[model samples]
Target: MKQILKNSPPTRGIDHLAFVTDDLPATMGFYTKVLQMKLVHVRRVPFEMDRGQPPYDNLRHYFFDMGHDQLLAFFEYPQGLDKQNRDLPGGMQHVAFYVPPEKFDDLIENVKAQNVNVIGPVALGGRFWSAYFYDPNGIRLELATTRLSTPGGIVESVYQSEEEARKELETLFDDPETVDYWLSQMPLKHQ
Candidate 1:
């Protein structure tokens, strides 16, 4: 008998997701030429050195339009990928970009034409479809399109009242095993 808050925080959508890249030119070429994402901006910024590392002059920061006001951005440093921790698998595993249903097939073909292997236009229990591929920087990327309706396509029920929704969410964390599995997946600092 918990009640959902009526005044939820205001948020639009993702602004951008940024990553470090070794070669800026090649990364830009792959995104713009292969993935067809438009290169929106490029800027030179002062490099921020890590503790115990000497300061470098500058780094290149660039962005690509992922449509729907979202962006995929990159940073190129002087030491390149070496600036990242090669010993630990601590960075992003992959990124999934949403593509409209109409354009999904064509985009898959475009990726294949670039000589990159495309994994699937596979269905996710009929809720959505996705295709996977890797970028020039070996970053696994996915393009997906939702097949769901405007609301409750995948949810078992659409709560009519805030109290109903809150009641359901209250029991969501009851499974200790599920919680433990998620916690275990977090990258260890010294691993």
Candidate 2:
């Protein structure tokens, strides 16, 4: 049985997702041609009226409409710009884009044509699959497709209220057997 907590703010879904790219044209090319996301807007940050500072300069900005009113945005900075890699162990990890289960393989093939380093179609438990690739800026991205959530099938954890999930986690404290099982299920990097 499941229980619901009172007074939790419901998610209203994504507004936008952003990334920094060294090669703006190439990055835009991949999202447009491969993933089929459409370019819907472009703009630069206005840094006008600064006191004794360098004149306001524009950055190359582009936004893609990733459907459901969500935008995927990228900012192109010149080479040797500040960067961070999200691949460190226990790092702030990957971003996932959902796709129809049937098109998942074709999506992989399309992205592969761009010659990006990618891995998987890996199992994320039964009936769901994920593929991983790194963007030009070394940010890992995932394309996940699931057929696992159909009615009367094995229930998978996809959405859980934080408090409810936390309560379940609280039971793991000092329980060696449960802790061991939980630890074993984590990816190798987290072990």
Candidate 3:
């Protein structure tokens, strides 16, 4: 753990997550209208399909503000959807955005008002709540909120000693009682 941490490059929050879109207008409308993200920038750049192929002169790149200085960007390219390997078991699965707990329910309703189905308020080991839905581009999106005590709360103690931390993590799944405690704390949606 120590060695891995030492070699890890320092990173701030994600600058943006980029996706490809076949219909730029609908993508722009869904993000800006339904999701309420601001359309911050747009530009066109030359794109090369292959080393030998002629460069495509008009690939449109656009950015949508996902708040807190984060961006969700899209590139409009011909046949971009067809070029993706949709059958891959583990490609880019989903993108999750954090929301304040107080505003979580309102956001869910807002998404529903836009005629999108949402599937959660599911508790993640009592540490957080997350709801999942798909964007107009069929990209899975998650809205999440951290509980009062987050999973990271134990990080300092857990990582205090490398060997001890490793041993605890390794055996963590073996304790059913601890797991039950976490599950028991999950918020009841109906209540």
Candidate 4:
């Protein structure tokens, strides 16, 4: 059995994530038009030519606010990178962003208007609702809102205490005698 130690809280979350793209302008247009992410910043990294250069290099960087302090960034090299299938296994999974419950309805409507296949503002219980869609580059994304209780307690079972959960599991479908026998078969640590 593992020894017990205090649990530490997670530190500050993501500031941004960067992806390399072949066509910078097309990608920017898609994010702005479909996703409604604003173009927050753009800059170029100058290549230093020996002494007192006249022309700055052409490498470019772009940033978009994906809400919160979270960001979506892209880099455009003069000779661009390959476009990889983001949906492949071990490839880019989906990105989910939090939304206010009130805004979820509007967000759902906006995303659908983009003609993208949007699935569910389906309430997972509580006040949470989540909608899923694919971005222009075929990257799957989820927009979600936390409602009354967190979503999991509604869609998925949740236990306030492990002991309570364990007791409930033990009593679920069995008589006392079968429960006792089954409990004996479980590992001591799990028990």
TM-score, one value per model: 0.67, 0.68, 0.69, 0.60
Q: What is the C-alpha lDDT of each candidate?
A: 0.70, 0.70, 0.71, 0.68
- Model 3 clashing-pair count: 0
Clashing pairs in 4: 127-147, 127-148, 128-147
Q: List the residue pairs that clash in candidate 3.
A: none
**RMSD in Å for all candidates:** 9.1, 8.0, 8.7, 9.6
Q: What is the lDDT of residue 72 in candidate 2?
A: 90
| Global lDDT of model 1 | 0.70
Q: For residues 95-174, write the lDDT of model 2, one tens digit per residue.
A: 88877777888889988887776788798764567899876667788998875656222223344444444457668676
Number of colliding residue pairs in each model? 0, 0, 0, 3
Model 1 misplaced stretches (Cα beyond 4 Å) = 1-8, 48-56, 79-90, 148-191
Report how far residue 66 has shifted in candidate 2, in Å: 1.5
Q: Lowest-scoring 10 consecutive residues by lDDT in candidate 2?
A: 182-191
Sort the candidates on lDDT, descending order: 3, 2, 1, 4
Residue 118's C-alpha lDDT in candidate 1? 90
In terms of TM-score, which candidate is strongest?
A: 3
Q: Ten residues in a row with the worst lDDT in model 3?
A: 153-162
Q: Residues 65-131, candidate 3: write the lDDT tens digits.
A: 9998899999886764454444487567788887877787888888889988899879785446889
